[model samples]
Target: MRINLRGLNRTKKTLADGTVKIFWYAWKGGPPLSGQPGEPEFIASYNAAVARKVITPAGVLLSILQGFQASSDWDDLADRTRRDYVKLIKVIEKDFGDMPLSALADQRARGEFMEWRDKRAKSSRRQADYGWQVLARILSWAQGRGLIARNPCEKGGRLYRGTRADNVWTDDDEASFLARAPAHLHLPLLIGLWTGQRQGDILALTWMQYDGAHIRLRQSKTGRRVVIKVGAPLKAALDPVRQKEGQILLNSDGAAWTPDGFRSSWRKACAASGVVGVTFNDLRGTAVTRLALSGCEVPEIATITGHSMRDVNAILDAHYLHRDQRLGDSAITKLENRTKSPN
Candidate 1:
């Protein structure tokens, strides 16, 4: 029997482990309806939800959150970012949903929010910071609408201080990984190191984006179109496996890789190869490092990597250039040549 209920929102999400989980909500941004559809408890909950005069009371945190979700600001976020924010919003709703919106305006509310963040940081600092950021964004949006006198989440500093500045892969690490990893993983590794593109962008890359000499695509995050003159190494790796259509990078099954699936495989391959302390993301910075070492100027490197001029400079200065002995050696050689020149 097919069951249809008006005002019910059903969402299906696939877990990292490939399990399908179905969620039922009374309405968009409304309370979740418990139990499976067609069950007595589910029907009862649905009835009660619809009967209620108001799902969320005004001047409460939950109401503000719902408002924010409906706003143009929320709709403007990138698809992946919006999905991530939805998870954080659920956490915020569970923790502080019923609290009066007025409490957020109190100067002391910032301390309380920080305390909540501190408890979460004990388990995962990066996750805690992400949650704080999302909550702050929501409060800021609410403040703009004049629902709150102030945003208490402002200036809540990060708990995760980990840096990947020095985490670029070395030549030996690259060799070991390629030797151990499956053949399908090779192209992705090469593309990251060569093009300096993010994992997501590379995974989403299609055959159409590549010409014989150049690969062109607009970065999903920044919307910047980058036309990379395919490096010798990447081009060599790409040629034999080049397809007439579909995504460039695929898994062992010859299908496009999901973010989670690729991450899991990449981690196992790294562990098997004895590679540690670096990630696929570090390839971006490594590309910048390699470019600088090859005598490419900042603007030129930025053009290839799709990073802004300032970002390229910061990556070189704060992360790679100062620490690289080769750059230091080149600087000394330049000084010696200048000193030896005829006056």
Candidate 2:
């Protein structure tokens, strides 16, 4: 495609703050071979040939989308994250209109372009964060393609500092919620509570991982096999949920529920049981806490919870530390009694 430069001039428009506005005009459909500008003919702008012809911003984005879809880098990314990129491109197109990455970079000069992103209305903070991540990725990719010299997002002010929701569940809360959960969800609930396995892993559990006396399953997040002896309470919970089929946890339709579905059901169960602020992930924290309270060593709890020693201790500090106060108090009382009796 060739650009038409007739009647268009490349000029530096001074801003109110005396900063130069850098701009050059070229044909939208193609590069300009020859055309006389109406003004500022003395200024010479460099004409460069691109490896791939960029006709429009939307065209470049479509190329990037196709490129990512066919590339190995797109593999192994979480399905949701991958979808976010596609969704984000559509969002940018809708909000800012399709423009070349180079042109977009130029427009990003004063950071007002990003202000539009912040002004967008979102249903949740998570959606807002996803938008930020999408823009960040696009800018990073643009930089790597040499389409832009630097990512304006690399300046870091445009990104949102999202708050992390809580992931702490108590034993009583877990018990209450599980009691109210549907009969079919027993195994899924046990896996969530006992192993702290992610919803995906729990839904993926097979009978081979469950031995008569212990459970051995590889964690998806870390790719580490964790083995834990079946405690009586957990065994009881699992007994009713065990199946001879492919997956230990299957929805009513005999298919595994997605994480989103599991989270929705979990929230409902929590509400029914009158347990507030307990997410499915809190079960993992509860498992770690229960192990620490039972006097399991730090390393042992880490094996069961798939936690680093530091994280295990942090959980212990938060949930199990105060529970040990009674033990300390009992020891002090015994010491006082012995001194009084000897006197």
Candidate 3:
């Protein structure tokens, strides 16, 4: 039986016996729904003329969200970068009212978002710049996928600049820091003062790194194995401090200190030692400076410090070539010895 509701008020089904089966409408004190008040009950219907599947507005919106799910490609980014990307969503929502991604991607809308970000209280300008850098990468990914025509942060420049720059530790400051470092930290401190390894690299030293008399390891950052002969001063500090702890250095709690924790404790030690304007990184610089001053060649210093020629040159210029009275006297002694007769 074929039923057509496009005709008179009541829809009819034509039966096999040539009889009409009328399906009457239930009115709510008026007329049939999608119809007018009772007349012939004929309602003009346009869809019956064609036969095509309908896509609702809700379905289109759902497909857009599905595309967003398809665009979830956060792999290969660094851990910190991935965290920053997650935070970008919150920044977007706070700056602009939550809307479909398409609607929010307008140039003016993005400009407004950046303006709102400038007014954010949680982050300073530099920090905000870092966040937006991550956002720019995400927008690039979106652009490649045809989600957006271009990156919104393409025009954003560096947010903050011109703060206090590099603060290298000085010679007198190094001597004072070493003299005041606690007995337990003495060897570790000397290693830091002699070898320009980062705190984490210094802390990573184990008994295995000591090959009978020398300390050596393939540095994590540079991937270069540097063998440093334990000199008298370093050995003297190491002798009494060496223990069955298996590792070279451990905190008061008998556990190894993380780089950040070591840096925090070292800062306190520096303050107590009365050394001002120095950073933990400056310790590495101090070690490199002292080595160059002690007549170690650039290659020799780089062997231990994991710095390249260019880096060593900077350290030498900033620290080594600046000669004092001690160096001048030594130079004069060498000259006199070379010209003088042995009587």
Each prediction's RMSD over C-alphas, in Å, is: 5.3, 15.6, 22.2
Candidate 1 residue lDDT tens string, 136-229: 9999888887888899998888899987767988999899989988888888899999999888788888887888799988776776788999
RMSD of 2: 15.6
C-alpha lDDT of candidate 1 relative to the true structure: 0.83
lDDT preference between candidates 1 and 3, better one: 1
lDDT of each: 0.83, 0.58, 0.59
- Against the true structure, whose TM-score is highest? 1
Q: Write the per-residue lDDT of candidate 2 for residues 1-343, one digit (tens) a residue.
A: 4544344334343322223443333422222222243333312321421222343344444444334433434433434455556667567656654444455456454265556555663454455556766666766765686756766655444344542224456557667766786776666666676775555566666666777677777665455677877777778877776766566666768777776777787677677788886566666776776666577899998887678899888767755455555447867898999989955
| Model 3 error, position 177 (Å) | 2.8
Best of the candidates, lDDT: 1
From the highest lDDT down, the ranking of the candidates is 1, 3, 2
Q: 1-343, model 3: which lDDT tens digit per residue?
A: 4345442333444322223444333311111222343333333322321111133133222233222312324323322333455466545534442344575457685676577658652568776776667556656666687766656667677767733224556667767877897655656777887778876678878766765468887664444677888878777777666664367888768787766677778778888899887677667877776777689899888887889978888766755445344567878899899889576
